[model samples]
Target: MAKTLNPSFSALYSYRIGSYYFHSNNRLFKFLGSRMRMKLIFKMNCDISFLAKIGDRLRLPHPLGVVIGAGVEIGNNVIIFQNVTLGSDGKKGKEKSYPKVGDNVIIYADSIILGNVKIGDNSVVGAKTFVTIDVPPNSLVIGNPCKIIIKN
Candidate 1:
């Protein structure tokens, strides 16, 4: 595939392959996948967890500095730019939580979504946005404090 050969898409390819192998029934394959994930973390600076569930047509335009934490679920047709983080609120508790991103979402660069937030479908999160609350569907979210605009 062209994605496999494209240098710009190397991080996405590695993540996809590692995710596939991590889900395999074979333990050896899981180990290898974990190693590959580690390589992706250390070398590529993209910390995408194998535990995270991602849907079809996920696009990472600039994969560097992207951190997707464990238990994060992303829906189909999501585009995430560079330095975007979807993770927990850094709370210490028995129950761990992460953000859930819906379908056809565009997360711009330097955006951070923390806690058990839910980003609804067909939403656009603007650059440098910080989201701690749930985002409604068909909305445009922007700014550091986050202002929501319902799309027509």
Candidate 2:
């Protein structure tokens, strides 16, 4: 499939390009990249910032309404579906308060992960789940308040 044909791919590429340019020391590239990122925010409704530390092969099945906060850290091969929000809580301190997603994790549609929570590797977050605590590795999380099930 052509990269241009896939909206998911387009979103990722746009993010990659914008991130690269935004991080550049050159002022002109930073300005252009910031412009592109703004366009992405308005057009695609994806509010991922260049400050986010996302690992390799991050997949967004449906990119719309996905908001990844500036300090969120996502590990490799993570899959995030539409309407998912990974953001920070109202708690203010010197520490980083955003959620950290582990490798090979699948965050289903409409899930909200907030605060200084750590999602363990190879876990699955069910659709519409709200998570505010640490999830263990190889677990399945589901429900509004979030229930953690240890997978064998």
Candidate 3:
């Protein structure tokens, strides 16, 4: 959205605004976002649900492969890189609960924050990390099985 001139900030702006409307249970807003959602998804290579409660200034520097679930709750000032998946397990029909991300967290590229997990505030999740458990606040986590390397 930011990289183009023809379809510029207006599209991205509309998407964010539309997302707000969709989150507020307004059909018009849903329609607006639905119209631009796929476009932006294709543009940025990401899928962020309108139902996902995102706080102020959620930054996506690189948006590719980001799959945020409907039930996910993101905190303020969170910086997420590419390939971050905040979602649930493969359970159909039943109500699924996504992750609850804390404030000031930095989730690096290719990190999977999945399935009812809570990423604590001020935490930093390293690249290619696969997280399936709750993370403590002010911690630095890395690795596939996931290791808590440092806790500030």
Candidate 4:
């Protein structure tokens, strides 16, 4: 079977357009002329930062303060709340791993998901929860050492 193309490629394309516009202009005033354009630039920066793994269905309530690490494979329909970090654990390079987030997952606010963990599809992670293990599909995890409170 042929490999599927990324759906967010169009968004990345538009981001590149903004990047080109920002770099092409010589005058500073003309560049930052309008407030809408400035906001567009900021959004473009966030989009381009994690251009590799961000899926088409990825929705950010507040794009700012959201950091997505490189090589992280995010599935479609994933909603990430603000102040969320999805990246490596930085364990002295003991093992190189990236979080593989499954489709239709909802990650709540201020949650820290570390290590090379696998979060299954349709799972909901509560706010302020710290997940370090593989969560089964359709499960709900909450608290410091995230546990399976509900199984679907």
Number of the top candidate by TM-score? 2
Q: Mind giving the per-residue lDDT tens digits that candidate 1 earns over 26-128?
A: 9999998998899888988899998999898889888889999999999999999999999988888658789999999999999999999999999999999
Better lDDT candidate (1, 4): 1
Is 1 or 3 the stronger prediction by TM-score? 1
Local error of candidate 1 at residue 73 (angstroms): 0.5
**Order of quality (lDDT):** 2, 1, 3, 4
Choose 2 or 4, whichever is better by lDDT: 2
lDDT of 4 by residue, 1-152 (tens): 22223323333444444445555555653353332244434653343332336565677655445566766888999988767788788888487567889999999988888878999999999999998999899999999978787673
- Point out the worst 10-residue segment of candidate 2 by lDDT: 88-97
Q: Which scores greater on TM-score, model 1 or model 2? A: 2
Q: Could you give the candidate ranking by TM-score, starting with the highest?
A: 2, 1, 3, 4
Whole-model lDDT per candidate: 0.92, 0.93, 0.81, 0.69
Every model's TM-score: 0.92, 0.95, 0.84, 0.68
lDDT for model 1 comes to: 0.92
Off by over 4 Å in 1: 1-8
lDDT of candidate 2 over 43-144, digit per residue (tens): 888889899999999999899999999999999999999999999896766565899999999999999999999999999999999999999999999997
Q: What is the C-alpha RMSD of each candidate to the true structure, in Å?
A: 1.6, 1.2, 3.2, 8.8
- Candidate 1 has its poorest 10 consecutive residues by lDDT at 2-11
Off by over 4 Å in 4: 1-48
> For model 3, what is the alpha-carbon lDDT of residue 4?
52
lDDT measured at residue 51 in model 2 versus the true structure, 0 to 100: 94
